[model samples]
Target: MYRVSLFPTRDLHLSDLRVALINYICAKQTGKHLIVRVEDGDKAHNIDGKDQELLDIIALFGISYSHLYYQSDNFKYHLQFASTLLDRKKAFICFCPDEKATPYDGRCEHLSPDEVLNNPNPFVIRMKTEPISDSFVIMARNKYPTYTFACAFDDMLQGVSTIIQDEAYLENSSKEELIRHAIGYDQAISYTHLPTVHESEKSVQWLLDQGYMPEAIANYLLLLSTPTPTEIFTLEEALSWFDIATISKDSVHFDMEKLGFINREHIKKLSDMELSKRIGYACENIGKLAKLYTKEVSTTLEIKQKIDVIFAKKEPLATFEAESKLLQELIFNAPYFEMFDEFQAYLLEKSNLHDEAFFKPLHFWLSGSVQGLELALMYPLIKNYLKEIVR
Candidate 1:
């Protein structure tokens, strides 16, 4: 059993998705139950409808939870456990007025229960910590339990066996462990703190806006932790190779270059029809371009731009002078090949002149770009562009 907490702040980011994905993978591979807990106990920071938005985001990534819970739902139990500590003389009510005080001095530790009940002042509950240790406050005067108290109590009550979180929370593990011991819970939940994703200037929304695929994002995230030899892979293939023990403890830096490379690889995997559908979502012209090229394109904008180049009213670039003879020959033998196989045989017959030097200028004239789809596939598109230009 594992429990992962998501705060569902108003401005959600990629880091939230990264944490959720790691936890989901861990639970799935280990055959353990996973609970997604919305940490809404701190109502002061909670936003309206943010919880449902968080759920929507989780579903967007195709992650599923065995159980869903809200920390606020167990508020009564949190307070009860804090009170239990008081009854067992493990904690006391501090009447101190200073809000900035740290390592509480236990000023009200000697106050009797009757005195605490009768003398009601704005007070906070402080754990009666031992010497060589600083006292910590678990509940404020407003009766709202601190994050540490609520998290620990609920983890125990909910039978959570493992806790997965970012490295920033490693400091709080000790505080939570103390609360667990104070509450008389013997079994300690295993802690696994995954390395944090270095803060990126580009937010998650920005990446999506730039036409990145979700699969590529997930693949890039996994590659940051695991040493996958290949640039592209499906989530199922990645899960088969995922091992929590192999995750690097050092923080992972977000590399946009690597992400773009992975995205290109994923784009290449899509069938032409599927690629057209995705392009159509962006622009119908791009979808028609996909049908014209009959090959994979890295982005919708790329295909659209290529189509514009082919349909430009201006003549092809003057740089095609070196291939002028080849161009005239291809035009004169206009209907040389109706099928790609016949074209390949024709190229094989002129193997000596079919090298990169011969093809490079031809590609430049046809696509306005030096690099593009294979000649076998691009032949038809180039012929069509030539016919339009001649007319």
Candidate 2:
């Protein structure tokens, strides 16, 4: 069985990342079981939906974790450990609130468990931290007093040997080491701290100034770790590259426009018929793709008008306006032709450019949106119908 743990502190985002890691790791190392534990020991700092939504999101990724553990579920264990340290004069029970706490309040450290027990109003168990010495180094603005006694024991009991975390947590190693000693787990577990991925600092500052979509944020994060950065691949190639180890640590900037461009590129690579089918499917879901130039349901009749005559030898227009001012202008301005007959004869004379020119109007007129099936594919259906009609 593989034991994994996360201190799902205040944000679900971190929890989701934890789940993603576990899912990825499990796939790479098959025949291994997975266990997930949430660290919610700090009830005071707890956030809503910490349990249910976190579970739901993890499951949504389709990873089947064998066992799930919650820290709060083991509150008695933490309390027991805290109690043992207290009895041994290793930890103190403090009743002080936020505003009045002091380092030397030795009030609780010195007080016997019984004494504090009798005088208790509301008591929070605080582990006795080692005195301020050269040992404690400041990394960020916050001063970290390692919980040597608790963290070590927990990590060892959980059997988590390698930690995949961010570098910002490097300073916590001291406390984790202490806790490791407290629990008597001597086995060495390698720690690989990943770089913090974020949009550029400037982009983050800009987001703070304006606003952004959470989906956009997640999309950016996924792109930061997207498997294929340069290579354009088909569906078959994509399904083969779903490994979690492929994720990168470089922070990606958030750009909805860029996301749209990438998605359009992906959609464009599909063949016309496939593009039409996918558009229909996308339309059913969001109705965004259904509303196109053709008032009708993009049937063969409408598609043919332009897609068909693509290879025709002549421009068959029955009416000037029916061909649209744009197409009319192209034909009228032709240097080789003086009249309609001359234009048709001239176009028919060049078989190579004939089909291409016929497809141009429909390709240009329909599918204003970027990247999809070629418009020419639909021309065969409506070409004959538009034949003398546009004359």
Candidate 3:
């Protein structure tokens, strides 16, 4: 069985996605159970519903798990393991002030039992670690099990054969192993530590809101500074070609430009009706308009921004302010025409505004830009809603 831990201290980051994806792939390939350990024991730092939110994001990526466990739910088991260590003289009670002692300082390791019981100050439990693994706090003064203690015992009790975690937890992982060995639960386990994506601190939902598609985000995470048979693929499609051994040991940085390109490619895959509905419209013409704008922009939000300007009230260029006013009245009373050329010719002759004078304000009135898709290409799709587009 493979396990992944999700901490609710913050929204799931790109590194988290990497962890989830790798675990899912490995478990699926081997036909073993995958478990999700929600490390939400730190109530003070946890965000309400963030644990569920992280799971939702993982689900969106199509990762499957056999069981879900909350670290807090196994509170009793964690305490039992902590006490066993204490009874064996492998751990001790420390009366150090909460803010006074740093991790693994061993300041109170020598305290006698009488001195410990006589002390009235709040105390935390610290493990007496071997030289290879540094000592650490097992249980806090609040009676809550520290992450290392809770996670170590849970993994041992639950039969997790493999753990995939970010490199940031490298030291903590070794300490968890130390605790397990100290407690005499010595079943062999495999650990795979992944490098963090240097600049991906935003939550998964943040990326979605910024208009990056889930497929695109998955594609990027799987291939960032790594080799891939192809540049773009769905999460499921990567399963066949994805090899766990190919993961890089060094960290990689996020590249917004490459992701933008991937996002654009995914956008192109959406149906016209789907595209229309995504930007608050249902008409196919609106969909077509959005797709046309895709050549110039990379995200759904960017496409909508360009499409929205056509329906918004006009904002003419200052250089063509006079031409704008003249063209506005000419367009309001102009006869309906099926083509941009026909409508344009009528305005050109009626306003007697030649070349730049005729076209610049006309461009702004219709699309709110002096430079954009040729008016000829845009006019037909929008002609039915010309009045709405120009005003």
* Winning candidate number (lDDT): 3
Tens digits of per-residue lDDT for model 3, 35-116 = 9999989989999988888998889888889999888889988888888999998888887676234455667888888898
> Candidate 2 lDDT, tens digit per residue, 31-78?
555667676655556676766655654454344576777665654565
Q: Which stretches of candidate 1 lie above 4 Å from their native place?
A: 98-100, 118-120, 281-391
Q: For candidate 1, give the lDDT.
A: 0.71
Give the range of the ten consecutive residues with the poorest summed lDDT in model 3: 98-107
For all predicted structures, in order, the TM-scores are 0.73, 0.51, 0.89
Q: Write the per-residue lDDT of candidate 1 for residues 1-391, one digit (tens) a residue.
A: 8876878565455666777777888888989998989999778878888888778766766778999999989999988888899888888888889633876566777987788888857988887777613777889888988888888888988899888788888877888999899877999689988787785767554676576767777778878777775758876676676777788888788888778777777766766556657655343333444654425545445555666664454343355554544553554355657676676466445533556555665555455565776655655544544555433
Alpha carbon lDDT of residue 248, candidate 3? Answer: 80
The TM-score obtained by model 2 is 0.51
Which pairs clash in the backbone of model 3? none
lDDT of 1 at 133: 36
Q: Which sequence of candidate numbers ranks them by lDDT, best first?
A: 3, 1, 2
lDDT against the true structure, each candidate: 0.71, 0.45, 0.84
Clashes of each: 0, 22, 0
